[model samples]
Target: MDLDAYVAAHAFEWQRLEALTKKRRLTGAEADELVERYQQVATHLSVVRTSAPDPSLVAHLSSLLSRARNRAAGGRTGTWRGVQLFFTDRFPAALYRLRWWWITTLVVNVVVTGVMIWWLLDHPLVEQSLLSPAEVDQLVNHDFEDYYSEYAASHFAAQVWVNNAWVAALCLALGILGFPIVYLLFTNMANVAILGSIMIRHDHGAHFWGLLLPHGLLELTAVFVAAGVGLKLFWSWVEPGELTRSQSIAREGRTAGTVALGLVAVLFVSGVIEAFVTPSGLPTWARVGIGILAEAVFFAYVFVLGRQAFHRGQTGDVDASLLEDRVATQA
Candidate 1:
């Protein structure tokens, strides 16, 4: 094929396709003509690639065909539809699909924390090593309870939210490293265990539980979810099953991203509880009850909505059409 002669013949059709694509509205005849032009230009591109193989011409035709294709396919989805789809399908399904990872993380961490607290209670020397006698007294007598009300509730809520969100984000970001996620979880649980031991030994066990449970229940759950998702991302590549390692990592990474974004809201709720409810004059049972309620609601959200979304084939990833096009290859 003579490249110059071919370009001369199809240039008009390409220009017409570009023009029709740029139109804001089209009459019936013009719409029909646009489709006709689009087909011609696509064919022109294919022939150029196969016969002439001019990079510049092929590139121009490729760009033109892309725009024409989007126009024919009705362009992008509406903003409301995208947002609704995210909450209804993407976020929840991701939670449900990765339930085991986070759930196991939550259980194991809780057990580790319990063991640490029990060990510290039995071994008094550990507390003295971690904190001086005066520091332990200060924390047990005043610091532990006062920490919640030290700042205005609203100010403190924002602060807690930002801090916890950063932790969750870090877990997700460092999850591929494997060790970092384990280190983060360990440090977090250790802090709680250390504090619990000091408080319980000082006869402030109920007080500690009162202040912690209201917010800790949901807050810790969010962190566990992040760690679990991160671990899943690490394992995705390690044991990719049938998919290629890259494919597995990419799939789990997207799910991790969804979990990360969703946890922001979860942490915010927990922050509110920690700031307001934890320090409130309500009975400990009531405060803990509210925390339990929030935690229950979250699990229900995952099991109910997430499970439903998963059953429908939702993998917490972006729409297939929106993902970049891929070319198949053989090993």
Candidate 2:
């Protein structure tokens, strides 16, 4: 395709475009010249990409064209449309892409939690080590039920919201560390297991389920999803496949950040339920029904809307315009 010669022929025009774009001030004629050269270079880049696929040449021309277009057009302002697009496309697609990771975490943690509960119940020594007979009696009889009603609903909701959000944020922010994600998730399972064991041991298992199922369904799912995303981020760089390690990390990091933001809303829902419904005197079945309903809606949001977004090729990553397409890389 004689790519070198083609580039050489248009080299002066390209140089002029670059110079005009770089200038802090430009004459009217120079501005017009920048637009004209930008168009010509766009055509050149297209020909180079089709006839001679050189990553270096294509990247260089792309960068020049991008700069020229920006100078010719000017900056775009943010709008409500950006927020709309985020929810409609990016956020859902990102979750759908990582569905398997989150689902696996959900299953594994649930199984581990059950096993821990059984282990604690079967071994008197384990339960004894955790809490003395008197303490266990108090926890199962009073503390477990009283914990929810201990604080006013409004105050409790805020506290739960912040605490759950912080835990989710920690899972997401420390996901790159790999082991931290595992540790964080394990700690969550242990807490649930300890409580479940104490309740079952005291023959208040129904009471435990009645209280836990309401908010626990959605709340725990949100936490699981956060931890899954974090572990996925760690795996991204560990096994990036075709992408360079840096590119893999950057892409996953951006997507993970979006997920963390999305979880804030999910956790908010869980928090509201925990404060109002969990502690409220709504019948146990009704509270569990509402929790299950909320959990169902979340899954539907991810599976239905998220699947649509993913199939349409939206990955919840930032707009292509925002990513530096000119990052030098070998083809």
Candidate 3:
């Protein structure tokens, strides 16, 4: 076919192929095959039945094809598409994978929480040291009823959500330093333990669960996910696997960072629920149900949508020099 006709005939298929490739992982052989096919198609298009093509024909074709493929692969159109790509495609795909981290963190947190609870139960003075006199007095007098009411009245849901979202973002960002993630996880666990101890001491543990589970589940999960992504980065540095430390770090950074942004979104939504819906005196069963439902939705997004969205492409240009260097260096 002539260059123009070939371009016109194959453009749509190429775009679809590009999107599919971006959204799904492919083996090295498959990637090589696809790249070869793409080059052949473009070469044929460049040579036949045309007056000399534009000098920048390959570059122009690649750019146009990339944009079309991006749009086809869930990218938005227009100026804001760049922003959306940053957040949705780039950010979320990098950072969010919490199951391993959550499991590890839950064990640590639970152990720490148990120790703290035991200490507080054994030495009441620990409570005095942790809780102010006024706070203790209020707890003893069952004045938490009024305190909670006042606390609930004062904080607007929107502000709480924004604040929590900011915290999650900060955790992910700071975690690049490595140690900050451990600190953040430890601090969060302390908070949960402290709160649990106070409630258990006051014989209001059930109420506390009702109030917290509604939002705490999702909020805590997000936090753990962020920490996990950070740990992944740290491990890449320490272990390096088959990749050089730098390459591994970069790859981990991209995937873990994107997933972290998604966690921030989860935290934002959870915070809103915690501030508003969770504290509204719902029944224990109702709170648990909501928490379970939210968790289900979060997992669905992470596993199903995440896999579909961030998988590596089957076709793309490979740097010949880089491959040659790796082969030579390894040999």
Candidate 4:
């Protein structure tokens, strides 16, 4: 049959099938017939429309076919139970697809750290330029010993951490509007420059490890990750690849959001250390150990847990703790 005639002949059947599928009440025979008819109609429509069938339509048809097959094998079961199972199985998969932001953020962090390290090593004068005279005086006196102590005890640590978190969130959120991401990047770079300067000017560039290797590790890494997400969202608008800018932005936004949440968690931990540990005159070795442990944990969470969460959905391996006895036995 010609495409038009086939569409005309089956139009009412297709409409009825779609309606029944929406109601989730098709009988086995009726679903089977509808599936067969949908396949034929879809093939004909493809020729006429010169495009693939809509994915939603294909999903609906496949679902109806599955429902029919299930009914044939076993009389019936509650639809709500099936839906619950579907969501339980699929939520991880959804989360997995949304992990690109975390990965991207991690990469950005590494790059930023590398850049900061190189700048501190290569350009001492610029580092000197970055710090204020009072900061420079503290560095000369080795008085930063007390500065970290004050920071740990003061309310300022909490305020600083909160402000940083808000700024990071704003960067991610503003990228949605397209222009704010540029400003976000510039602001972040300035902050990095100031931090790098502090490390270099203090202790005659000798205390870099003491100053930054501790709390700076997680805190700076979080900042870089947040910046990376912002950059990705901004780039989505400027270079959207094959998709429309809006579509690309939306896709990247989901990943960026997850990464931002992870950053917030990092900031919370880092802030506590900065407020209480760094400033409290902890032994240098102790501070180093704490920083190293925190970084290790953060790394594992981002690279290991993050990857598993991303790919877990595709493997259909539910966490053992969440599975009931029947589900476990069936598996």
Best by TM-score: 1
Q: lDDT (CA) for every model shown?
A: 0.88, 0.87, 0.60, 0.59
Which one wins by lDDT: 3 or 4? 3
- TM-score of every model versus the real structure: 0.84, 0.78, 0.63, 0.54
After superposition, candidate 3 runs with Cα above 4 Å error: 1-98, 139-155, 303-331
lDDT of 4 by residue, 1-331 (tens): 2534545666676666555445455677865665565454444444433433456655554454444334332322245764454333333333344346535665655576567757765777765576667777766566655556554355857776897798778877876665675566555655655555565645445455665567877776666566656766787888999989876776676667555655666788887777776755677788878988998887665446545645554322333222221111110
The candidate that wins on lDDT is 1
Q: Give the candidate order by descending TM-score.
A: 1, 2, 3, 4
Give one clash count per candidate, in the order shown: 0, 1, 16, 4
What TM-score should be assigned to candidate 2? 0.78
**Across residues 1-331, which tens digit of lDDT does each residue of candidate 3 receive?**
3556756876765664465456455466655545544454444334531444555655665554444333333322335775555544444334333346555765666678678777767777777888897887576456544433456533755566676666666665775587887787677777767767777787788876777788777877776666666676677788899999888777666656556555656777786677666757777798778888998887776556544445742111121221211111110
**Where does candidate 2 stray beyond 4 Å?**
1-77, 327-331
Q: For model 2, what is the error of residue 22's alpha carbon versus the real structure, in angstroms, after optimal superposition?
A: 16
Model 2, 1-331: lDDT tens digits are: 7878887888998888889889987788887787678767777777777789899988898988888766665522145766676777788899999999999999999999999999988987888887888998889889988999999999999999999999999999999999998998899899999889888878899999999999999999999999999999999999998999999999999999889888888999999999999989899899999999999999999999999999999887776645543422321
Report the C-alpha displacement of residue 190, candidate 3, in angstroms: 1.5
Q: Residue 260 of model 1: what lDDT?
A: 87
- Model 2: which ten-residue window has the lowest total lDDT? 322-331
Model 2 Cα shift for residue 143 (angstroms): 1.3
